[model samples]
Target: MSVYNQPRRRVIQMIMIGMILLIVARLFVLQVVEKKYAKLADANAVSRKVVYPSRGIIFDRKGKSILGNDAMYDLVVIPANAKNIDTAYLCQILNIDKEEYKKRMLTAILKNGRVRQSVFAPLLPPEVFGRLQESMYLFQPGFELVQRQIRSYPYAAAASILGYIGEISPQLLDNEAYKAYQMGDYLGLTGLEKTYENVLMGQRGIQYLVKDNLNRPQGPYENGEFDSAAVAGKNLRLSLDIELQVLGENLMKNKIGSIVAIDPTTGGILAMVSSPTFDPNLLTGSYRSANFSRLYQDTTKPLFNRALQARYPPGSTFKPMIALVALDEGVITPSYGYPCGGAYYGCSRPIRCTHSGGGHAANLRLALANSCNSYFSHVYRLSVDAQKFGGIKIGGMQKWADYMHAFGFGHRIGVDVPGENGGLIPDSAFYNRRYKGSWNSCTSVFLGIGQGEVLLTPLQMANAMCIVANKGYYYIPHFVRSIDNDDTDLLAKYKEKHVVAHISDSAYQTVINGMTDVIERGTGRKAAIEGVRVGGKTGTAENKAIINGVLTAQKDHSMFVAFAPADNPKIAIAVVVENAGFGATYAAPIASLMMEKYLKDSIPAKRNPVVKFLLEANTIPPAMQQKSKLDSLNRKAAATLKNGAGGRTFR
Candidate 1:
């Protein structure tokens, strides 16, 4: 009986000892290892504050900060600390009643649980901030003014490309990636801001301060040993030419279209204008929400970045790519010729040519220069229906689609900006899905002429021009030229060279020579610049839209793609004007003016008339805007381009 009692006593003793150890370990963790509860404990006699660093500045090629930061104030409140203060005067300064103040206090309590701080009044206007600063101490520890840096665009241009920032949403706060961010924190919403958020958002700092019984900050806790300094966001240098951007925006004023210009040598975007752009300042500071609501509801869609999103047909601009594919596949030679009285009879429906009598389709370069529809249609049939590819279904069509992919189609080209759309490039599988596996190349023959089943963003067209300009290789189009005070992998991918499949240099020359002729003596003659060789292609993309439950044939979208100083190509540009009559009429001239500006640094004074007429032209369909919807800010900018010569011919 004694032995059994001893064993039970030992077991009870061991259990008691184990429970005591567990309790001790938890106490140790709460006291030292984990700082969460320690901070809570510190809250009684200490104030922990967050210090936000200034956001990175965005500079153009000239080192001018087009997208910069301007200091603003936020009124922060800790619900538990708010006591025995002038609630009425505070409300009066904020222009809110007692009920509204109570409502805000309740909201702050719910957000931060009565202990932590939350934003009460954010992005205060200059006058309100001045009034509040005069008597802020009267509010005691419950409220404080915090200085924050908000974005400012001095040029007030590139709204779509620079993008906007807004307070973090509850959805974003719940995300694991954003767990560290508070509810009132702002984050990039679109464009380059969204794309480079990680680098642009610097590290936040924490400071611990001793507080008096009245909740006033007495001094640094433990002599400031625990405080962390804030780190400023890394700055970025862009390839964008803001002056060029402004000019493009001015020319694209009162229109529905896009202009994408790139440095063909480096694949750096020189200027990108999504017409109907609003002032970037509209999306900043205290008025951001109200201004955004207005812009979002506008009929012209001033917020949309058309340069990287609009999916318009490449039109005759695609003829050169077709010629490249044909030349690469051994289906056609540089000297290949066809006899076309007026139309191509090979397909079920006749495809008409601009040049009817005969010699238009006489050779590859000649056909390209003339933009003969019959010639490219015949070449498309020959490549897809050729025996070497085992006919269209077996291999040919997919190969053609492969070439299209190599040219940066059918997928995002990964430009440094966000919201880029990979426009449609109908492959065999696509045809198989749409036509259920029973269709011929002629069924999509218009694709050969850049009219059917092939849609591309202006950026894609511009990038394709870079590929042509570089002969076979291209760098991904990007806005950032360099990152300042940083050694990171931020720009690594943009630095890589993307090479298309090996194609003969001679084949590229043939296509390039024809494009040069296009500016010299063909459809794109208007695109030529004095003493500078130019290569250009004009396009008229047929379009249709649904209106009141009816599919109506809208006016063709005028388009043009070009490369300047043709031999040693410096710039490549693509301009698209929606609902504009002919490519040569609107798009060609727009591209021409832009190219001239980029190459000569200014449009020759002689071409002032054409620039003036285009600047004042309103090409947006009447249905899109019954009256001009151009914002007053942009209208003022556009007015700068109005001081030129009189009206001139479109071509």
Candidate 2:
């Protein structure tokens, strides 16, 4: 009995010793091993703060302010640190409801941990911020009034091109690329802003600041050694001429369509105007909530970038390219001739020639001058028919399409701006999908005349004219000419010549001759400039629309393409007006005005006696109304011709 009791006593003593060792180990962890964690917990009880940097600025080509920053204040609160503060008094001072304050506090707690750090609420007005600052001491320890910068667009114009920045969404914040950005940081949403975000959004910096128990910053920590300086964003000098852009926008007021102007030598976009444009300032700040909703709901879609986004049939403006292909393929010489009687090739689908009294017989030059469909149809068929060429034809519809591709159609031009769509250039794949491999060469005849499945943007159309003006190659169109405060190497990528095709210099000469005739005697005479040789083409594309599930003919789309100083071409332009009768009537006049402004710095007065007479004749007798209409149409047609195509008469 004594031995068993002694063993039990030893067991009890060993258990007590093990318990004492476990307590010692716990005390060691709490006092020594976990000292850093304990220190952090104690520091959090005293103060915590965050610093936000100012956003960058945006400048135009001239270094004039396009977008800049404005000072504002943000309302911030810390749920864990806000204690024993009168809720009613705080709400009154901050100009917020009690419920809103409560909700904000709950949201902050959820977003941030239960730490004493300040959390940002939505942006507040300057007045509200002022009120909060006035009574800031009355609030809890962690409440703060943080000054911040807001985006402001100075010009308010070029909304489509400059685009706007907006707050980052939750999903965007989750993206790896956006990990560094805070939830409320602004991001480029469209246009140049989106395209050059990296260059525009400068590097973010950080610094350490000592704070008091109230969480207010108490100057820099460690003599500012820990601070990192922010790098300002670089500025862009776009090629766009601000004065011309303003002028173009004003001229197109109350109209629907677009106008694009390019410097043929540099591919610099001089002016791009889309009617129904909105002020970009509407999208940049505290006012964005109300203004953006209004802009989004507007029926006209003023936000759309019509110059680069809208696609339309090349119409007769495409004839120049077709003529080039025909001549280059040896399908037809400049001397080729055909009869035009308001139709082409006697096909059942007769094309109505703009010429009066049905149509007249035409040669290649005359055909382009008069815009005769028959001669073009003959060349179009001859250029593409292998069987007609005795199986030796290398210039067919596919070859014509390839030439169009070389002209920068049916593909993206790789402009620096974002949201550029590769306008459709139907290939065998597209045709197979549409017709299931049953389509043939005859099915694509309309493409010869720049219709059916062939689409082009105003920029593409202007580029085509520039290509022709340059006599062959063209630089890829770009907006930024140079970057401000950047080294020359910054533009190395853009300085290289982007040759789309290398047609022989002789081929360009033949096409230029026809284009010259079109301006001197053909369909673009109205686009002529005094003391300056100008070449151009006019197009009147038939409109088809679905009405009650039935396709019907509607108003025509007027279009014109022109280049100034034809002998030494400087500027090339394209203008399109939706539902605007004839190309030579409305479109040609506008193109002529833009060229006059660009070349001579002023519009030339209306000096054509025929046009002046027609203007005055409109006030004449009622019996002359029919004659007046015909005279007006003929004068416009003659102007188009005198600008190049119809001066030589082949009797």
Task: Report the number of the highest-TM-score candidate.
Answer: 1
Q: How close is candidate 1 to the true structure, as a TM-score?
A: 0.90
lDDT of candidate 2 over 553-626, digit per residue (tens) = 87788889989888898889999877776788767877777778777776545545533432332212244233
The segments of candidate 1 whose C-alpha lies over 4 angstroms from its true place after superposition are 1-45, 109-113, 210-223, 627-630, 633-651
lDDT of 2: 0.70
Candidate 2 ranges with C-alpha deviation above 4 Å: 1-63, 76-96, 102-123, 137-148, 346-349, 356-361, 387-395, 436-440, 487-491, 604-651
Model 1, 1-651: lDDT tens per residue?
688699899999999999999999999999989876786576678767788888888999888888777778889988898899999899999999999999999988877679877889988877889998888778968898887878867787888988988888778988998887887777888988888787788988888878776556778887777789889888889999999999998898888899999998888999999988887776777767766777787889888889988898899999999999999989889999999888889978777765669887789888888899888888998888888989999998988889999999989999988888999998888999999987997898988889878889999999999999899989999999998888888788888999997888888999999999888888899888889999989998899889899989988899999998899999999999999878998889888888888888888789989988998898877766865444653444334324320001000
- Model 1 residue 565 distance off true place after TM-score fit, in angstroms: 1.3
Q: With candidate 2 superimposed using the best TM-score fit, by how many Å does residue 611's alpha carbon deviate from the native?
A: 16
lDDT (C-alpha, whole model) for all candidates? 0.85, 0.70
Residue 534 of model 2, lDDT score? 81
Worst 10 residues of 2 by lDDT: 642-651
